[model samples]
Target chain A: MNVTDLCGLAPPEPLERILVWLDAAEPDEVATFRLPHVPYPLFDHLTLRPCCWDTTEQADGTALVRIVRQ
Target chain B: MINPEFSLPLAVPLRFFRTAPLWLLLAGVLFLLEPSTVLSSRHAPEALALTHALMLGFAGNIMLGALLQVAAVVAGVRAARAGLAGLMVWLGLQLGVALLVAGLWFMQPLLLQGAALSLSLTLLPLAGWLFVRLCRSPACDPTSTGLAFSVLALVTTVLLGSALVLVLTRGAALPFAALLRQHVLWGSAGWAGMLLTSVAVTVVPMFLVTPPWPAKLVRLLVPGTFLLLLAMLCWPVLMPLLVLPAAALVLPLWRLLQQSKRCVDPARWLWAWGGLNLLLVFGLSPWQAEDGILDAVVLGGQFLLGGLLPIFTAMLGKIIPFLLWLDYRRQRPLAGPLRHMGQLFPERWLKYLGWLALVAGLCWPWGGVAATAAGGVLLVYALLLLGMLRQACCKAVAALVV
Candidate 1:
């Protein structure tokens, strides 16, 4: 499992890091992303790629997204 | 696993984005030609044309495109053929806005009639489709709910506008003053204001990294504002109540700005400016109905241009560059060095334009030489933004080859 903690980062930085990670990952590799919010736009972006992600809201108002490159 | 339901093409919104600056430039030209129109009574023919140019041509274009994008993202509303719908709406707006502006500018009844027909045909079906989709959407979030109400307001606005056109063109014995007032209210506060608030609820937090607005307050805002508008319409004496929502938003915006951790960008400052001007609009609203035509015109200009212009300009600056970057990433492999958002468009240029727009909006109400000078400022601002957009697109396309 790969973890990319993206808390405190703004906008394109977080999105950019995730894409770079996703692009380099092997098939079926799972990655977890800790984000400032639920990242709905990321969900929209993921539709174009062969990836599945589940977002879980944390008690502290942040979000954890688990993504698997399929 | 979340189902990926939205796959709207970037081109869907890009077309509208590209076309909008031209309309703003056109409004600038009209203002330059007749500076008095900027501060003249709203009933003046040139003033009417100029208003439509900004409202229907510039702002309407941006909002329609944005609505499609936002609806897809927030509500998971998928269009059957987004490209085709986008094209149809784009063409309709081009034709309708041109005719409406020319018709009013020249005081031609026939052209006004045609403009009314075209705009109605284009906007009504689009609004209906969005409303239905929003109703059936699974997402019950505040953004989605607010979008739904805003669409309803848009429908009401368009209908009232069409009726006003008939009165103007066909001499339909309607109370022109009353109908025009209702049309402006529904269009300005009900449609544009509601939509801005809805977008802000999601955008401000996400982009600025500020604490989210209190959910309960966010939830109540759209419906509460809508009810206030309805009350104002039914009982004209309740006009002062308009200040409540404006005040609600201004306080929260001030709070959010203080809490934000993100580095300052043109968008944030523009939003602050927009919020401040919005308060001014509401503050000045009660006086509009009482005696001062000049005050009324200035208030109209402030609401239509000052109140929303900065916010829209800010969104354009933020959104376009990001969209360009996203498009480049989607089309290319990640092997090359990733392009940053700032590289697509210069941050300083946006900063400069933001200040310029502020100056233009401030001087616009003064009329005479000041307004004309402001018009020149707007012309330069539009040209700069248009150039930036073009350069950004060209750069993105160039990256495809490298």
Candidate 2:
């Protein structure tokens, strides 16, 4: 999980919006996010996946995620 | 620290993306001037040349360029020296396509042999390089594996294509029909189609605001496609099956787009058009058609509408705009205006291009004056697309400099 992964491809898909969410998210806290695209490695710089991280598919094909930070 | 090579300069893949439409332009002009030559039959030299121009010159260019971008962005790995590799392959393909098209048109054995040699040098090496880079990617995902398989397909296409060139030049003593079918199948459904389906999993979900592909489905699509291709060698009747997986994955995408609450888009239109054509053309065994002009039309129409044009249309309307804005943002980290794709280019023009591509795809099969008109229209479509892309580039640059 690296930030470089997030910076490589795709634009205009709420990437920046997700980053804003990450900025406001409580540090060392667990949260759930349903994003249109993977915000993992990009959010990994915040240590979002250092603990319990699970990704599953929604009926419409987006990712439903729960990250439990230590 | 990010590896310095993690991202190829924006210019690297964009060069191929920009250059692809030129091939379509050349194909349309060639078909227009030599309508009779192209309309005669599927076996006609002119028709063969035209197909090569659209297939290798146009489709191949986009596939290679996109992979370089996808590898770095999606898979978290980069092709070392992508710019140099892209340049060599670009020059080689241009020369090879020119020589091959001329050879097919003039029925010149020496030129055909030379074209084969040139393509071999370019495509084979590039495929190897790409395959290695994809394998080294940090992300172990379906897209990466599918890309590796697609490169293998490219290698296979080159080998068979070169052999066919030798056979055409009378340099080889072998049967032609079986080998030709194999070649077309591997190149179209295997290399191009596989790559398209693989990319669709991410591109459709991400850009279109549609549901992501079911993980189970995405994981098996590429490897299953390859196995089907391998089996086709033993059972020729399975040729139609080669297109089935791609059609299956994309058909649902169209339905998803229809049900999507996202705003209307020309890119969506192009993708839907492609999905429809894929079903119409490859839904059945094309070998069942009797030999004649109609058969030629069906085959060519299927690949053009079902495979190439629709794919490129989506790419142009959707991917290019995002790439442009991404580059612009890199320049203005703080005060840069974040513009949506519709702001960069009018959606009306793209929607028109979508219809134009659809009309041209449908019109290609009706030979004679209609075919000529179709070619002419396609040429216009290609030119307009190139113009719009260039404008996008210029605007992005202006924003950066200003």
What would the DockQ be for model 1?
Answer: 0.44
What digit string (tens of lDDT, one per residue) describes model 1 on residues B269-325? 888888898888887787765234337767777776677788888778777777777
Q: Which candidate number has the best lDDT? A: 1
Candidate 1, residue A5: Cα displacement in angstroms equals 6.1
Shift in Å, residue A60, candidate 1: 10
DockQ of each two-chain model: 0.44, 0.17
Question: How does residue B362 of candidate 2 score in lDDT?
Answer: 72
Off by over 4 Å in 2: A1-10, A18-70, B1-5, B291-294
Best by TM-score, which number?
1
Clashing pairs in 2: A60-B211, A61-B212
TM-score of each: 0.93, 0.86
